[model samples]
Target: MPHSVTDTTTPASHPTASDTSGRTDALHSVPTGLYIDGVWRESSDASTIAVENPATGRTLLDIASATPTDGAAALDAAVAAADDWARTSPRHRGEILRRAFDLLTERAEHFATLITLEMGKPLAQARGEVAYGAEFFRWYSEESVRIDGRWSTSPDGKSRLMTMRQPVGPTLMITPWNFPLAMGTRKIGPAIAAGCTMVIKPASQTPLTMLALADLMTEVGVPAGVLNVIPTRTSGAVMTPLITDPRLRKLTFTGSTPVGKDLIRQSAEQVLRVSMELGGNAPFLVFEDADIEAAVDGAMLAKMRNMGEACTAANRFLVHQSVADDFAALLAQKMTAERLGAGIDDGVTVGPLIDDKQRRKVAELVTDAVDRGADLTVGGERIDGPGYFYTPTVLTNVQPGSAVLREEIFGPVAPIATFTDDDDAIARANDTEYGLAAYAFTASTARTIKVAESLDFGMIGINQGIISNAAAPFGGMKHSGFGREGGPEGIAEYVETKYIGINPLDATVRNSHTDAR
Candidate 1:
């Protein structure tokens, strides 16, 4: 069910010290209201959605909730700005993005605090997100001027052919909540760099980060209508009309596979170009020759990053039979040692889940795994508190058919399964509908090459836990969705290619006549 919106104007009180860990002032400073056509204002119907602090389950603030009319207006704004923005000099656009990157870095602390408040990532992790997210702007700023095309003679000797890339025109961007700031910058940076105007509908659960980001863009002189942000409780209600509208030339979404499919279906009506970054059930493989300590470190980073709410989080830990016990023991110890609490709290390593619903889902998956013969190594229950807190759990001897092995567990839970050899590991890793990301830890150069090549996932981490980088393309295969984000390929998703051919026969004839004269 969607959260209810209200028209009340009174401000919500700040959470207590225990709730925010002394970051209440930063929370109070976050921007509210919808940003459209360079102006920030209330929704057309004056309704507002309450922004809740996932750590405390307290109302942090209320953001203006956009309606269908507001969505249409945002589209109108994007369409209106499309022509001029596309015509704007690439260098000028690059400069604006560069400034935004600098400004974001300067204001990283502020944005990081807002992200922790709304998205429930630990402050340190949120800071890491800010740094990673800000890099997209810098990277795309460099890419803006590098949008090159091709020119050459045609196969027919008399003709010359040229190809150029143009903005797909006004675009609709829908970002997910898990990594609020990074997700927005990943899409928005490329769109802006490609000279495409955008109407962004950020996830309501973490809209504040993007809302605050809008202010940063505005401060850096992003033109009116080039970017419009609309936050609403009912995403489909607000986005459906825009998705169907002919003016919306492209649609980019980062969310679940089902939602991405629905959006893709709607986009087909207009033959709209689309990009989807959907779900994942990443497998973390540990071979017999792997260093147990290094493998455990990688597992902690892969499985516990963002409290394991990430699509790329390692859902199934596949270890060799020889070292499975050691790997699971070390992983269990690290998982237990993680200090779980409010994101804003100092020294807190793991934060609460996004909300009660997410907590419930994590709990159910753990219960199901335990019921299916998996050994509960450590931390398997929800913490009794006001916040949506769940223990960082580890389950070893996980049954092959356990739901944890098949599903994307979007929480701090790691399930270990044993594999006999390289072939077995590869088979088990690829036995899912999702092929977003996969990891393998092995000291042998030959094994690393074999496993990395054999795995069906789009992105692979040979020995490293972290795979995302601004300079590398990030995307998935199979049901994880199509299209790439980051690197040079990122901006290309927002542009269309056109070919022009010209006959040189007339010019040749004119040259001959001139020579005869």
Candidate 2:
């Protein structure tokens, strides 16, 4: 998956550290060493990764990468902090989490700018992700204090049973590049709230947002060793050692399905707890009774958000045959008209792909579909510019078994397929191994419910484009992966239940006390 880098295009000159675009200040603030045990230090052997700006293909910063020795130190820090963090009162944890939420809000604009600079997301959407990211801290703050257990009588009436929820202990969170700030907060909020200490490893492509988040949490009173952030260029130097350590109680990942499965096998060596939000190939279904106008509006955000880099982004469009022509027309118009430029530029709605390789992958899929008879409604070409830009694409007359429908098309390409009825649409939608998210549009209330229930996905959105929030559990199904990352249930992923049974001595054994009574 690695590719050759060529910085052929010169980066645009911008304002220095005082500029509000925030990249200058943000880049200056990136710690020179790994943040471990609440302090910064260099890794053994001294290796670093060059952080790049996807929009301009410019080297933004050279961050010191974590080595195996550094990762071992981080794991040790978490292990040392686990017991005290677990023993800390839930109310205290909740208060700190809420404080972190407030701090994130206060610095929202800066971090959002950092997100845009690193990952090529438009500024507006980057701010939106900042808001979404902060919500987890707020939601899990309340969730931390609300976690409860129960007591019950045994069947024999001679013993009492009680169940208590305990922290899963030290954990490791491996987040993806697509949502740097949100992914870290999504896992960190619950891990800290559930009294678990953790080490965070954000994707090297986008680690600044995470580094900024770690800074904010430390400033908000997260204790030393309770949280750690380590970024490494090579996985074997860090991942293998950490995943194999028995002391690491849990490891949650948000990445590709193949990598997730590999992590599962690695975690099996220790039988540790794991939560994976992996790859997805979602289907956006539009029925005959649906409002074509409304569905088109939904389609714009559903498929083009983050330039369609999200795992939950609608990958396949299954439109009812009756309204296929109208839906395709409106969708194609909106997609082709979207403005693409640098993420920092004002009014730019669509940005570049993460890299040239990703852009080429998207291009390959589009080429395959076109050769297979899929009509190129609009935008089947790459934008000619300095940035790694690809025009938002829409396609119809899609053939069966095409790569767009079969694989996770993590780009701005929408392949439209027609179905005659509900059964056909449902079958078409459920034909993939990925089942992370599915969407549907219908006027009938009964049909809406029926389609929502019938879709084989972890989450279904009917007449809605945005479904993820801190108040709802977000994860995947089947090859899309398992375990939830948000809502009340999200905190539960970091907890373990223990049942204790108590028995009372027979009354006859205490004759002296009984006589006195």
lDDT by residue for model 2 over 206-309, one digit each (tens)? 98888888888999999999999999999756998999998999999999999999999999999999999999999999999998999999988899999999
TM-score of each: 0.95, 0.94
The stretch of ten residues in a row with the least summed lDDT in candidate 1 is: 1-10
Q: Which ranges in model 1 have alpha carbons more than 4 Å from their true place? A: 1-20, 506-517
What is candidate 2's local distance difference test score? 0.88
Model 2, position 322: C-alpha lDDT score: 91
Colliding pairs, model 1: none
Query: Candidate 2, residue 162: CA error in Å?
Result: 0.1
